[model samples]
Target: MKAPPFEYHRPSSLDEALGLLAELDEAKILAGGQSLLPLMSLRLGRPEHVVDIGDLGILDSLVVEPDGSVRVGALVTHRQVETSAEVAAHAPLLHAAAPMIGHRPIRTRGTVCGSIAHADPAAEMPAVALACNAAITAVSSRAAREIAAADFFEGYLQTVIEPDEIVTRVQFGPWPRHRRGAVVEQSRRSGDYAIIGLACWLDIEDNTITDAALSFFGVSDTPIRVAEAEDVLRGQAPTQSTFSAAGRTAAGVLRPTSDIHASANYRRHLAAVLTERGLAKATAESGETR
Candidate 1:
């Protein structure tokens, strides 16, 4: 199906885009168009105006900050993050998670900020951002502000960003040398969306787990950090038993809804299995670095 009729505006500058957004009603920002276009074609989205920020030359940068965080601009594609040495060194989790996004063609066009703005519950970048403690920057004609990843997501395909505010950049960072992370997912196929996915991070010191972050996607309306499961891993040895316990704790607390692809109980089982697998991989990576 073709998308419904809508007026389109191609803004050449960020300020112009902001002005267009402020002046237009039911306006949608088009950065990468990986998610929005498809939804529009399916009649799921019916925006009256599409403010194309594609020509906004200012939003295409990927920079590493002085404090060790990687800032991904609104137009920085997943392929850029996948190939960036600065991102790989400073924010390894983002690097590790980049390649897992859909496929090469999708990565070539999909923007990190776009993904975060889209906030699909099954998307990898959102959960990765949550686990990395990333900060999202939102800008409007009136003011600019930063939103924590933990509070940015509200529900399935929902975020706290207002209609007039555009997400400019997302910063992922402060990855200490002692911190190790990994991402694992159980998809229907290689490039399909995950049936269940986990982004695991562990800070290990002297063969003991000092801190842990376990963020899961495809199990709820939003990517959730299971604090109860994380507490189970803290101060414990990075052992199979500990990981299994954490997995069980996460499964117990997760309340996933049934869908055509999977039942709620089946997803709970996947949650348990993937949690163990992801934590084990992260722990092994940490051990190797030590």
Candidate 2:
């Protein structure tokens, strides 16, 4: 299916893009267009105008700040994040999750900020952002503001982005040393959207968990940071029993919905199994578990 007829504007500058968005209330910003085009083709999204931000060179940059955080422009593709040395060194969790997004072609054309803005509950980046405590920068005609990952996602396919705002960059803090893990579920096909997924990071000291972040996707209205599970794991020496208990806690706390891909019960089971496996993998990777 082809997209509906719409006026297209290619803005060369960020200011120009902002002005266009401000002027056209029904305009949608086009970044990678991987998600937007699909929706448009299906007639799910009909905008009066399409504002293309592809030519804004500043939004295409990837910079590592002095504070060890990696700043990813909204236009950066999944492939870029997957292969970035700075991202790999500082935030391997993002690198690990990037390749799971989709096939090479889709990743090549999909933008990181676009995925977050689309807010697919099942996608990898949103969970990664939540787990890493990333910050998102949004710009509008009036002023710019930074939103933390926790507050950015409001519900399934919904976000805090106002109609006239554009997400410009995503800033991710360095992964805590001594912990990293990622897991996903798909049916016998690589690049398929996950039926369920999990990612975890742990900071360990003296054989005890110091800090931890655990995120889940494909089983909730939005990517969820399992705070109760994290709380159970923190300050505990990682043992088989502790891991098992934490997994159960996470499974019980999740509120999943039945869908075409999976039932709520099945997703809850996956959440438990994945949590145990992910935590174990993270602990081992961190060398916290012998």
Candidate 3:
């Protein structure tokens, strides 16, 4: 299917792009076009104006800040995140989740900020952002603000971003060398959206779990951070039984909806399985025997 006819403006600068977004009614920002183009092609989204920010070099940076936090620009592709040594060392969870987004070709054209802005419940990037406590930067002609990950996503394919605002970057808090993270998911195929996905990490000291993050995707309207499960792991030794209990707790608290790809019960079961597996993997990566 062909996309509906729309006025396309290729803005050369961020200020020009912001002006276009603020001036046009029913305008859509196009960075990588991996998400918006598909919707437009399917006629699911029929914006009157398409503000293309592809040439805005200011939004194409991927920088590790002085404080060690990694800032991913709106135009930073998934492939760039996957291959970035700074991202791998500073934000291991983002690096680990990047390769799981889709196939290589898709990653090459898909932007990290675009995925987070899309707010798909089945997407991995949002869940990773949630687990890492990322701050999404939204810029408008009037002002700029940072939206916390917890407050950014509103519902399925929905976000708190105003129509005139563009998500310019996402800053993931630092994950030190001692902290370990992992991403695990169940999908129909290698590149398909996850049926149920888990992005988890552990902060361990002296072979005991000091803290843990359990963020689940494809289980609710938004990516959920299961505090109850994290509570179960805190202060406990990183052992099989502890992870299993946390897994059960996560499954018990979640209310996954039934879908054609997976039943509610099956999703719950996968959530439990992936939580356990992901925690164990992260613990092992941290070199904790207990």
CA RMSD, predictions in order: 1.4, 2.0, 1.8
Backbone clash pairs in model 1 (N, Cα, C under 3 Å; residues 3+ apart or in different chains), count: 0
- Output the lDDT of residue 209, model 2: 83
Per-residue lDDT tens digits of candidate 3, residues 12-60?
A: 8888888888888999888889899989999999999999889989899
Give the TM-score of each candidate.
0.97, 0.95, 0.97
* lDDT (10s digit) by residue, model 1, range 149-184: 999999889999999899999988678878878899
Model 3 Cα RMSD, 1 decimal: 1.8
| Highest lDDT model number | 3
Candidate 1: give its CA RMSD in angstroms. Answer: 1.4
Provide the overall lDDT of each model, using Cα atoms, as 2-decimal numbers: 0.90, 0.86, 0.92
Worst 10 residues of 1 by lDDT: 281-290
Ranking by lDDT, best first?
A: 3, 1, 2
Candidate 1 off by > 4 Å: 286-290
Model 2 bad stretches (over 4 Å): 186-188, 286-290
Q: Local error of candidate 3 at 131, Å?
A: 0.2
Quote model 3's TM-score. Answer: 0.97
Compared with the true structure, model 2 gives a TM-score of 0.95
